[model samples]
Target: MLALQPVDTVAPAFRPEPVTQEEAAAMFRAALGLFGKWELTDDQAATLLDMPVRTYRRWKAEGPGRISRDGCARLSNLMGIHKALRIIFAEARRGYGWIKAGNDAFAGSSALDVMLGGELTDLMRVRRYLDATRGGW
Candidate 1:
């Protein structure tokens, strides 16, 4: 006689921690660094971040205060795009320059041009494009 055992198919529940102000500030700082690498102007960076140029400059000079949920999401997407670029190109300069290089995927427009749309989905679209290009979902 043989006995059959049933395996558990349920996955454990996942609860992510709440985003803190300090963490959001840190992300903003990282985004600023990426902007510098991409050679984005203050106005361009502000537009991409969906913030006013004045606010962006303030944050750059003083510090990032509490970031909204949408703001956090935007920052995350921007960083994800940078990370995927880093993985796709061997040289960091190539990855940084790729943002301004024309691509057929964007109708001959650069990825930076696409992201400059100033919408969260715009940033997400760029991130997804880079992620898929680098064999990520």
Candidate 2:
């Protein structure tokens, strides 16, 4: 009898590809649109984007410009979260409201609360949770 050996299946590190100026702007716009749909306050939006209130206001008014790589990553994760919510929930309202609704996954905290931690990891956590719920993992 021949002995079988186990195969290594470790995935590569997740390094996000560089985004173009237009792609970054488009993602920022999409995230802002989701913010409006979710009825998030200015403070909440600022927190979600990991930006100061003043900077948020400037971006809101002036429109998305050349944002930093971190900003692009944050917006991309938020957009992914929004997309995952829409995919998981049947109703549009439920999808939109889920952000503010308490979730057992976040220790009974709302997804918005977890996102308001003002860190890239917080946003990624919420996005990853939603993706997993949708079986995208």
Candidate 3:
């Protein structure tokens, strides 16, 4: 006769709160600031955000409006990547410079280049790379 032991299931400890419109707007504004710090042109920023160039320009000039969930996600990933870079490099300039610097991990392409793939997953990939490099989530 064989006895079967019960398996214990554990729930996740952390659950994120739903993002509010204000929070989304704030993230959009912050992403614009990050673009300036990273010296990303409008086209590059739009590409990274997975938005049309016209929309990006409009948002930049008129202010944050109707940021979709996917757009917020892209902004969040960009912020996460920036934070990881800040933690990894003591100098802020170094962190900014690193975005455009070639890396073997990205197949000799800059992190910005990888992110310019114009997909939400592309932004996430850069964030994941930075997180892994810095030994953080």
Candidate 4:
């Protein structure tokens, strides 16, 4: 008869600390120094970025390779608004439920127009309206 071996499982310890700009520069330099030494999985890459599987799929379908935080979020928001507006316009033309849908389509702009004198486009229209009407938010 042969003796059975027991499995040993232990998780690695990690500590988190805020990185200053100088620390960030040095850390990135050190990490980059070990290029092609460590092997990483596709799942590991996605997991490291905290991306959802579905979001990763859509992004990969668009183009291969890594995606940036700001660019991806901005593109996703624009695409969502575009699709919604298309549906709203189609429904409005067919004479269905335009009253509520149209009301808040441009909440910031409409509110700004209501108050008047928002010549500058750089400013947040809703915030500008609030500043003009009330003190400030």
Candidate 5:
């Protein structure tokens, strides 16, 4: 006879590591470059960054110094999405254009549209979708 012990079903609490100021600035720069590669307009970039258009412009012009925690998370997610796209699509053009290409998974909405919703989760959703496409999940 064997006795089975109940496994702990509770998930571990998520504790995100503190991002350094320099790291945040670098991520912001990378995210901006990604937006450029995707041919995103200023408005689109602002939306993705989850900031107003004016604030985005100011940050772009002045360069990021100490971005908020949420801003860092958003940029990190954007960079992750970009990396996933690059991995999934062998062609650089395809990877860049995939953001605007309609997807069945998003009810025919483009990944760009989903990401433009200005929420961190929106970026994560698109990244997860691309990751799954590349058999990452």
Candidate 6:
């Protein structure tokens, strides 16, 4: 609250600033880039998109079978990979920072083992086979 000094008292007032079109586009780009860094959380994503969280939430809940066009490239790319991996390992057990399975579909020896265990020998074997076929070995 401000004490009333009365109008025409010869005091300068604070004025709000506005953005031009180019500036607005630049801001949109920056906001979208921020959306890519974090894990998929609705409110956080909305904040990155520069929308009020509740407004974003409402739009999402509408269930129109669509996502907004503002998803940044990094977010899209990571989400695509995550979805693909889920489909590939649908039957695999997940826990302790990795998923492992009987057939080891991902890393071919339980996901956790390959992820944490530096199994270069296993990697080399797979690479060797591919190399032989490609005539690069």
Best by TM-score: 1
Tens digit of per-residue lDDT, candidate 3, span 1-137: 99999887987789888788899888889989999999999999999888889999999999978878888888889889989999999999999999999999999999989898888888889889889989986
lDDT of 1 by residue, 4-94 (tens): 9998999989998867888889989999999999999999999988999999999999999779999988888888988999899999999
Q: Whole-model lDDT, candidate 1?
A: 0.92
What residue runs in model 4 are displaced by over 4 Å at the alpha carbon?
A: 1-67, 91-137
Candidate 4, residues 1-137: lDDT per residue as tens digits? Answer: 99999876776678755444454334333322211122223343234224565654554454433434433332333233223433444553332222113335355344213212312231234334324334333
Please provide, for model 5 over 1-137, each residue's C-alpha lDDT reduced to its tens digit, 9 standing for 90 to 100. Answer: 99999999999999977998899999998888888889999999998887889988888999975689898888888888888888888898899998999989999999999999888999889988888888888
TM-score for each prediction?
0.89, 0.85, 0.87, 0.23, 0.85, 0.26
Model 3 segments beyond 4 Å from truth? 1-15
Residue 64, candidate 5: Cα error in Å is 1.2
Question: Sorted on lDDT, highest at the top, how do the candidates line up?
Answer: 1, 3, 2, 5, 6, 4
- For residues 9-105, could you state the per-residue lDDT of candidate 2 as single tens digits? 9988999779998998888888788889999998999998778889899989999757898898898898899889889998989999889999899
Extract clashing residue pairs from model 5. none
Clashes of 1: 0
Runs in model 5 lying further than 4 Å from the true structure: 1-16
Give the per-residue Cα lDDT of candidate 3 at 71: 83
Top lDDT prediction, candidate number: 1
Q: Extract clashing residue pairs from model 1.
A: none
For all candidates in order, the CA lDDT equals 0.92, 0.89, 0.90, 0.35, 0.88, 0.40
Q: What is the TM-score of candidate 2? A: 0.85
lDDT pick, better of 3 and 6: 3
lDDT of 3: 0.90
